[model samples]
Target: MTTATAIVAGHGLALRRSLPLPNPPGRPTTVSLSARSLPHARRRTIVPVSPSPRRPCRCRSISSESSTAASAASDTVEEDAEPAETYDEDEDEELDPQAEVCYLDPDADPEAIREWELDFCSRPILDARGKKVWELVVCDATLSLQFTRYFPNNAINSVTLRDALASVPEALGVPLPDRVRFFRSQMQTIITRACGELGLKAVPSRRCVSLLLWLDERYEAVYSRHPGFQAGTRPLLALDNPFPTTLPENLVGDKWAFVQLPFSAVREEVESLERRYAFGAGLDLDLLGFELDDSTLVPGVAVESSRAKPLAAWMNGLEICAMEVDTGRGSLILSAGVSTRYIYSGYEKTPAATQEAEAWEAAKKACGGLHFLAIQENLNSDGCVGFWLLLDLPPPPV
Candidate 1:
């Protein structure tokens, strides 16, 4: 067999031409060029190197008669030598046409029709796609108001109590105060008002429990006042005592000793109570005590000035005993304490002893659902002061 080669620079390809073979694996026999062939014979030439890369082509001839047949075969071979288009996995992945073709079921139910909505509304969304696609993930979120763990001087970081405060707005309400003390007063008033509105029945108990009741009433009141603790608008009065409730070093005398409540521990206790007692069960405050000493400076208004003296004195002298459950709204707040006489009874003096008894009975019934329970007590420092809040529970199973 005879072969010829040529480089196709323009097409970057090699062409090959083959001549007819005598037999398979046979040795070639050389023959002299004829005088006629010498006149027409063309010398092979090497092409100059081109800047562009190219492939060389080859040609072969077996005999003069078969040369034409070889040329014809070469032409067919040239067509076969065309460059094939290259395929790349990386490029294909990037230009995946199927990506835009969503395969979601058309028969699927609408998102709103589901029993529960799984929302990514609060989650961050993607922005762009490329070699390094951009994504927006939720980072740190900020609270509009500043706060800290309650009880600075104690061991317990009181997150649960602080959160409880945040939850109570009716007892806490509007016109944000600049100072914490003022905030406390506003909260206390809110609590008292709620107790009054709820008509919580009162027992003679320590004032501390009553204070707690006030706190609970205020919490319930906010539900009616602002509804939800919505933002972007003014926040309804919400209770939040970030300050630690521990005795300060100044009070404890260089001693770091403090009786504190850890937020986690409180949470566990609350959860356990909820399971054991019932959903929305009243929190146990038996271990908790409030001792307002003379050194403990009260802020906000003067009692005769702020009408807080009776409330303050009651608070300082009392210790929380226990919470009781009543009807409709559970009596979450209940305790007994020393009683003091007040100048005003908000009742008329009657000569008939029976009339006074009847009035007292009516007064007791009237106080049944009043949420806030406040009283003036000439109670001793160690005397118990009872307070109570109304908890509206789900109706008991029949």
Candidate 2:
């Protein structure tokens, strides 16, 4: 029997079914921002009092004084022009440190399975050819249900799922509380234990499951319970060997678990991560030598890589030394620690260009923008020092 649940998506936020089962899909919800109202009075300019105009001088006498006053004003102008001390209210704007900004595209057609790459800091598997392979992991609601039923006693009870969701007060409406929270606390334990035995991380369950639900267009009833989990469709595989101790076997089902990943896609994701972190963030890419590059140069993007160029060219362009990785059933993620030498040392290091960049950085900082300032210290060694000049903005008016 399938329990009822609704998938809710919003402009900046998307939520999984808040109500576990037997709940109706409600209206589209929005995260509200409080607005502050300013006072209605108009600002008045302060004028200097003119000493009662020296007993109201006549027009002829005032004309004579005007010439003398003009000379005095000229003398004061030089002193006043010494840079006014104006306050910058914009200096306090803050950066949103949040990782992902998400929204549900209700128009999301489950029938259309969009493909994305999962990155990893390290290889998750080895193919039959003895080649190291990456994995792209995703969050699977069905998988969650599988683990939910697989170990119902230890997992978050279905009743708690319902209550937590129901706790979302009408004022701050969303179908469920943050689904990620559920995964981190309740679902994560079961998944990690299950997949960890198979040497995979559990975070990809969301991305993987969301991908399937969106592409398949199956209803909540299809996934509300855990019984049908054994029949989950197998993902396309290009590897010659089966995953280690992951396949379900009657002899020892508890000893093993399995996750599906596409090898080519994994390679692509790792390559992309390498290029992105290396070029933009100065991430070291040494450990990512295994990932093959698939980038081709477009006209406007000056740095060009040919289809035939070795993948290492991308890494060479940016002096990356290593990467941090997380891998799982259907996902592979790679976080590169970029080399400082490449980040600071672009193709050209002319004096004029350096000065211009410094000035631009200063201006950007003043305007509350991202300032990529260069450190004068030597960056040849591994430990290079750098700092970020970020904007500091006040919280949105409540």
Backbone clashes under 3 angstroms, per model: 64, 51
Where model 2 places Cα greater than 4 Å from the true spot, the runs are 1-105, 111-301, 305-309, 312-350, 359-398
Find the 10 residues in a row with the least total lDDT in model 2: 251-260
RMSD to the hidden true structure, all candidates: 47.1, 31.0
Best by TM-score: 2
lDDT of 1 at 272: 46
What TM-scores do the predictions have? 0.15, 0.19
lDDT of 1 by residue, 242-263 (tens): 2112221111110000011122
For model 2, how does the per-residue alpha-carbon lDDT over 1-398 read when each residue is reduced to its tens digit? 11111111111111221211111122122111111111112222222222122211101111111111111111211231111112123421221211111222333333332222121111212335443322212222222111110112223343433332233223222232122311122234443444444333334211121232222211111221223222222222211111222111111100100111122222222234434322222211121111112211000001111221232233233222211111111111111111121111111223332332333223222222211211111211211122111121111000
Query: Native-vs-model 1 lDDT?
Result: 0.21
Question: Which residue segments of model 1 deviate by more than 4 Å?
Answer: 1-148, 152-211, 214-342, 345-354, 357-361, 367-398
